[model samples]
Target: MLKRRTRDFHQLSPVANALFHVIAASLAIIAVFPFLFVLIISFTDENTLARNGYRLIPEKWSVDAYHYIFQTGDSLLRSYGVTLFVTIVGTLISLCIITLYAYAISRKSFKYRGFFSFIAFFTMLFNGGLVPTYIVVTQLLDMKDSIWALIMPMAVNAFYIMIMRTFFSTMVPDAIIESGRIDGAGEFQTFIRLVLPLSLPGIATIALFSTLGYWNDWFNALLYIDNPDLVPLQSMLMRIENSMQFILQNSNNASLSSGILQNMPQDTSRMAMVVLATGPIILAYPFFQRYFVQGLTIGAVKE
Candidate 1:
């Protein structure tokens, strides 16, 4: 009877449940309001925005900001192509390396697991300084002015490998590996055919992290890439933003025509850049939602 009665111990009372719902809904709105406002402001007319300040509903709407961004459609498309290639390739490479390293360390049977784990964990605490890293990439590897400059720099992360290791250690049962071995499967075959299928949540979590890191990485491009053709979407957008700021700062210069400054969609263009940068990544979240939540919760909890 005591065991049966314990089932309701965790249940919320009606009033408490209603209060939680209200609080959650309120917090969700508070979090989402800024992004929605930015999207609205991006469509607002620049003159009206300057005149009235920010408003949920603007006096006038315009697509001139988007038009400015798409002014050179070919260059925009090329940058998009480069960014897509980097994100996809980098994420896949990161996942492969992280999972393999993490799985090896998670296994108790692996003789050198402790040594390799220390190596991975050690990287999290320290790294070669920027100058040395730059020298390695440019002089040693010779990836300067190349697309590899963008992808290779962010191809592995020690923190992500640790997360995956935690997930494997806590969530995967030893019996599964034993069963595969008993069925005459080799180590590589067992990992590929059995383990990977059950590890989707953890893999999805790592993949999303890797994808975001690669997509948003412009610093590497700034460091190693000199060729305009190798610039990713984020780098290109950043360059455009810098050019806009320069023009605005020097608006009073006699060489610059007043008409060009007057017609520039400065405010709206900044918001538009946010929308373009974040839109695809936001769409990607839904696909990973189920696995991502499960992975995070399970990976964090240790027996």
Candidate 2:
């Protein structure tokens, strides 16, 4: 009887496992479908895209849209360079400022830590709104139409600083700091040599976050930038989308000209532009993901 019961349980287990696998597979497909569709659409020929919209497999494959974008060569290449430069410079500046501020807050001896924390936390909950901030950026700071507008306004994020401070307080040993002091290391030296090395995971995590923010940002460019030369990849993608929409809506507009408008593949071009703009970040993510996960896990635990 016991053997029969065991056999019955074993038989049921396989059926249950199969059901679970079916559900998990369905969820995975649902999550991945949009990305797959975008990739398919990017390669689809203009005529097929205009006639049938997107398909899992392209009826006809053409690199015409990509060719056109690359034909504009220097424009796309220069935008890419600007994006890379801003992302790198902005991430480094943000990381340095956030680390120093977080370290200051983490020190128990800092007399005004609580007051400073309150001010930082307060800004998270409330802000002067868009108009006032715009006035400050454009009028007061005179950052309008410049790359500084993109990098300066959001250089330091308070929440990230707090997370870093929490990680420092919890993970870094007090005795290690004391030993460094005994060795006659100055405060800045101790922070540079000891604190930073130990805080690699947190720093990398924040750097990735800041870089992603800078890379994906378009609002700053939209509001301030007038020179086409200064546009970042995201802003250029937005312009491409808008231009495609305009061409679609006003297909009759004389400005398009006959042969050029007829040959222009708006739908496929939009998808291709999206792929081009986002391709770098997607390719770069896996390398940084492990550091991001480690930082989040370490920073999450409180002292």
Candidate 3:
């Protein structure tokens, strides 16, 4: 009777189930509100925003924010292309390096797993200072103004590698690996043909992380890029916004201040920039959501 009662306790009453969904739905709305507000503000008229402050429903609507961004469509297009290329290439390379390193360390038979694992963990604690790293990239490698500079800097993160290793160590079955060896499959072959198919959730999690990192990166471009054509979208937006901020900050002359203020696209354009920069990356989350959840949860509780 006690065992039966224990089993019955696992099931929730109808009121409890309804309460769970209500809480979940409220949390979801809270999560979605910031993005929706930014989007709504982007469509709001500059005058209306200045007059009324922020609102879910604006008194006046305008496409002026988009119009401001689209003023130089060619530059915008070029930046978008550069961002896309960097994100795709960087995420792929990061995943390759991370997964292989993770898989190697996960194997008990590997001779130097401890050494390599130490190296990976050590990175999380410390780093070469920025000035020296900058000199290496700029003076030694001479990658200034090159897209490779952007791609290489953030290619692999140690924390991410550790997560992947944890996933591989805990989730992959030992018997499956032994079976692969029994079938005369080499390390690389087994990894590609067998391991990857089973490790989709973990791979997808890192891929999503890397994708967001690359797509949102601008500091690398700011440091290395001198070529106008190679600027990524985030950097491009930063430049535009920074220029406006500079003007506003230094406008000691009232004549100049009035002239600039009269013609400026206003806060709507800033919100529009946020919307434009973030929209594509946010859309990608849904595709990876299932795998990402599994990967995070599976390794969270270790046996």
The candidate maximizing lDDT is 3
Model 1 residue 106 distance off true place after TM-score fit, in angstroms: 1.2
Candidate 3 residue pairs that clash: none
Q: Candidate 3, overall lDDT?
A: 0.89
The runs of at least 3 residues in candidate 3 whose Cα sits more than 4 Å from the true structure, single-residue gaps closed, are 1-13, 250-260, 293-303
What clash count goes with each model?
0, 0, 0
- Residue-level lDDT of model 1, residues 1-303, one tens digit each, is 787678778788999999999999999999989999999999999999999999999999999899988886787788888989999888888899989999999999999999999999999999998999999999999999988888888888999889989988877888778888999998889889777777889899888888899889889989998888888889999999998999999988999999989888998999999998887788778878877666445432135
lDDT per residue (tens digit) for residues 188-248 in model 3: 9989876777788989989999999999999998889999999999999998898778777
Alpha-carbon RMSD of each model? 3.1, 5.8, 3.4
Q: Higher TM-score: candidate 2 or 3?
A: 3
TM of each candidate vs. truth:
0.90, 0.81, 0.89
Error of 3 at 18 (Å): 2.6
**Stronger candidate by TM-score (1 vs 3):** 1
What's the distance in Å from true for residue 251, model 1?
A: 1.6
Question: Pairs clashing in candidate 2?
Answer: none
Per-model lDDT: 0.88, 0.83, 0.89
